[model samples]
Target: MTDSVGFDFARLSPRDRYKLLIGTVVPRPIAWVTTVDPEGRPNAAPYSFFNCLSADPAIVALGIEFRPDGAPKDTGRNIRASGCFTVNIVSDALVEAMNVCAVPFPPEVDELERAGLALVPGVAVASPRIAAAPAALECRLHSFLEIGNSREIVLGEVVHAHLRADAVDDRLHVDPAVLDAVGRMGGHGYARTRDRFDLPTMSLAEFTARTDASDA
Candidate 1:
């Protein structure tokens, strides 16, 4: 590699390491997660450090951060209390509401109500799902990885899912264009999923043939 910046993560400050990670990760899928407290009050929050980890059991992971006061955030606390939550896919139209959920509101405040998003009863989980969300995955807490003081990695098994009517076909194939999802970029930035291209996996023979042809 040519001249590239390097860092010793062990020596770097946590904040600096975080900055680099978020900056280089480019666009990350936003998981607009919802969970319910003991009183059944729903809590909503957006976490970019989230993705599907397994397909066989349908597992999704969310990197939930703790508050600066060393206490778990509302969503984290609610998930631990309820053992279930909903992961709502954030579409372009719901970006504003998603941002509203990210606000550090008090635990007593209902983010769904404050954001003016409709919440529907979750079929498989106690947590509610955002009705406006293009797709919502009802997840049961499979496991929790307590890595450090900063964040907790939650691995959830998707028990059920809800998708927009026009976004999916009978064959269960989802149309990305119809979903119109958005991703979180570094520091107050976001990216659209519209501009996309497809590239098929190539066989070794095909790859060799292409390389020979190019050499010729």
Candidate 2:
């Protein structure tokens, strides 16, 4: 057996814990979130600590960190004020643009425009969707959990989804090859979804048959 190393999270500093977690989590999905302030100024930011949690309610969760000075980030504030936001899937083609959106721009700055990205009006929410995104999820604020003073977990229930016409078939199965989504790795690293494989689950009877044939 290979040797193993472990660190007790309770004894580690937040930064150290973050490094360990992000480093070992492999490629996490990126949520290119878009929201509009009360004044209608659009904001865009990319967060890797995000995922879909519940399909029955179509809930998605985003882990947003508070600013170092202890203020909520623009995206968090905007979502609280507007009660809505849109999550745009970052594709290989949009990786650079997504990075641009991650810049520490002032709240007044329109990151989408700064990144030279286009937006489409949300059908069910006021927040706009990235026009070039392969997929966009329109969501309404379902709940918010304040974790300590440094982080927050935002739960948004997806009300609608928009997919590139070519990416989805009649039965709504998305073609991963067409989507070409990008994911966040540790630090400055990123990963592509192009390399993939499939393994189907075997039933108990099939497993037994396989074992019997192997013994024979």
Candidate 3:
């Protein structure tokens, strides 16, 4: 194998570092986060720096970036104020609507309505979920961490999840084909989950047998 070029992140500007990271991360899941302000007005936004961090405690983390003017974004502020939010899983059908929500709308604006997406009330949280989403997780704020002036990490404990009835099975296994999730790629690209392959984990004995077979 040839040696790979490396760039020192410490020397790179924040924008350059972000560009490199996002460009190389392949496809990241989009968290269509929904939150409500103090007056119960709904807000929705899409964050690519979001994922399930823990299964036992059902924790999800969102890396929310502050606005260029050094103020928290509406979604971040709403979550901070209410201590709860809902994360809707973006599917292929909802990608356009999700992008509409990503627009930098003013705090008073309802992105959900602007995007023309239907809303469903959250059971465990005051925030609502996108009715078109394949799945939605009702999360309460577990913790909030200020990483730097640029970003805030919001940790949420999922209290309840609503999955599309036909997408999940009795065993709680979700069918990716049915879900048809869309993931964020670098730049203006998005990826589909339809092109997928499964690889089952192998036991030690199975690994040894495979090795032996290869050697033979």
Return the top candidate by lDDT.
Answer: 2
Q: In candidate 1, what are the lDDT values of residues 96-188, reduced to their tens digit?
A: 999999899998888888899999999988999999999999999998999999999999999999999999999999999988999988888
Q: Each model's C-alpha lDDT?
A: 0.93, 0.95, 0.92
| TM-score winner between candidates 1 and 3 | 3
After superposition, the stretches of candidate 3 with alpha carbons farther than 4 Å from their true spots are none
> What would the per-residue lDDT of candidate 3 be over residues 1-216, giving only the tens digit for each residue?
999999999999999999999999979999999999999899999999998999999999999999999999998999989999999999888888999999998888878888998899989889999998989999999999988999999999999999999999999999998789999889898999899988999999999999999999
Deviation (Å) of 39 in candidate 3: 0.9
Worst 10 residues of 2 by lDDT: 105-114
Model 3's alpha-carbon lDDT is: 0.92
Error of model 3, residue 136, in angstroms: 0.3
- Candidate 2 local lDDT, residue 170: 98
Pairs of colliding residues, candidate 3: none
Considering lDDT, where higher is better, how would the candidates rank from best to worst? 2, 1, 3
Better of 1 and 3 by lDDT: 1
Give stretches of model 1 more than 4 Å off: none
* Residue 78 CA displacement from its true place in model 1, Å: 0.7
Worst 10 residues of 3 by lDDT: 105-114
